[model samples]
Target: MNLNIKILNQKEINNMKISKKFTSIFLAGLLSASVAFSTPA
Candidate 1:
């Protein structure tokens, strides 16, 4: 039971880490895209 709880906690932590990484990447892409679009052609 304890081992299962530990594994679940680890999975949650890993998922949080992945989500943070994905958010950062998504934000960066959005920022770059906005800058490109806003630039005068």
Candidate 2:
């Protein structure tokens, strides 16, 4: 299915990119921390 979407301005696009990058990094760190705590050395 196709949906109509509005275009984003340059500043908005840049903000979106930065937020997504930050979210990925945060998730990765959380995952690593959980694994470290759950697994025995």
| lDDT of model 1 at position 34 | 100
Q: Rate the local accuracy (lDDT) of all candidates.
A: 0.99, 0.84
Residues 1-41 of candidate 2 have per-residue lDDT tens digits of: 12323334656788999999999999999999999999998
Q: lDDT of model 1 at residue 18?
A: 100
Q: Which candidate should be chosen as best, given TM-score against the real structure?
A: 1
What does candidate 2 score on TM? Answer: 0.67
Query: TM-score for all predictions?
Result: 0.73, 0.67
Supply every candidate's count of residue pairs whose N, Cα or C atoms clash at under 3 angstroms: 0, 0
Itemize residue pairs with steric clashes in candidate 2. Answer: none
Candidate 1: tens digits of C-alpha lDDT, residues 1-41: 99999999999999999999999999999999999999988
Best lDDT among the predictions, by candidate number: 1
Could you tell me how far off, in angstroms, the CA of residue 35 lies in candidate 2 after the best superposition? 0.5
